[model samples]
Target: MIGGILVLAAMLLTGTLTFWQQVERALADNAYTFANSYLDMAVTLAGVLMVLRGLVYVLRMQRELRNFKDDTWSCLELLIHGLRDDVRSIRRHLPIMLGGLLLLGLLSRLQLILGGVGFNDGWAELILVGIGVLMVYAFFRYRLQVHVRPRLEALEAVRRELAGDSLKPDDL
Candidate 1:
């Protein structure tokens, strides 16, 4: 494997061989094939950030209305308005996300080749990237445990109160 890499590296640097240039071009050709998908991922992420923003906005508006002694209707309207806007935002990004994901599936085969897995061509790269994504998710969820678990646990008390289940903050 090391020997094969050394040979390929030499060929890429030399440029005396047309084959190496062709391979490089092939690898780089669909650079934007996944651009939209990546953008879609960003847009989806912004939706989560917006939830926090909306919560702040709602709380501020609710507090301001309390001064006027007629806050219920205003708060409800603000919540509904924010929700509608968020739903529209998410809906708008759906097609972009789907298109981008489809492109990722087509273009992500580069992963296996770059990762030095010995897969030069074909659908194996796509499958490998899929497996890679799953492995990454599992690592984050189980091994690293770095994502959503903490937030969920922290909110457990609120969730139980909302459901009228209990007032215990034990999980937190």
Candidate 2:
């Protein structure tokens, strides 16, 4: 999912950059009217694409959750097999995520120090970082509710049943 978003963002940035270049060309040719129209169109198109991408993302997430709930036995099996590795992987990625955020901040500060003017006030990157954090939190919550807790409860029940069986006096 993150990969899909990154790819979409890259494509949008490419399209926007291409439109910006066309605007520059129009201005260089003294076609101010054409430049203004193209700039407006580019901004509008980018905004629409962003909104559409967000809607698609939400729809995809909902579909995934539904599918997950439908095949919870598979989810439980996966958790049983890989829960420890999943946890260790998450632990490893935490520092990477934090480092990426720190690097983003440092780069933004460095650009400012170098008298570089950005297109926006860095709010876009901050929002992306915030969303990433929220997604990670949501994933953990979902796993706990849907996978880990259920599996733990199942194991507990099995243990209790075994204990009760051992207490029976028939085959001793």
- Model 2 reaches what TM-score against the true structure? 0.35
Residue pairs clashing in model 1 are 37-100
Q: Please list the C-alpha lDDT of all candidates, in the order they appear.
A: 0.47, 0.54
Please give, for residues 1-172, the per-residue lDDT of candidate 1 as tens digits.
4564455455434433443444455558765333223333333343444444455555656555564564544544544454444444444543354445446666545554565554554465455545654564455345223433444344454444555576466855
Clash tally for model 2: 0
Model 2: residue 13 alpha-carbon error in angstroms: 22
Task: Assess the local accuracy of residue 48 in candidate 1 as a C-alpha lDDT between 0 and 100.
Answer: 42
TM for every model, in the order presented, reads 0.28, 0.35
Give me the runs in candidate 2 sitting further than 4 Å from their true place: 1-81, 91-106, 114-120, 156-172
Per-residue lDDT of candidate 2, residues 84-146 (tens digit): 444443456544654555455555445544654445645455556556556766786677668
Candidate 1 versus the native: TM-score?
0.28
What is the lDDT for 32 in model 2?
A: 47
Q: C-alpha displacement of 121 in model 2, angstroms? A: 2.5
Model 1 residue 153 distance off true place after TM-score fit, in angstroms: 29
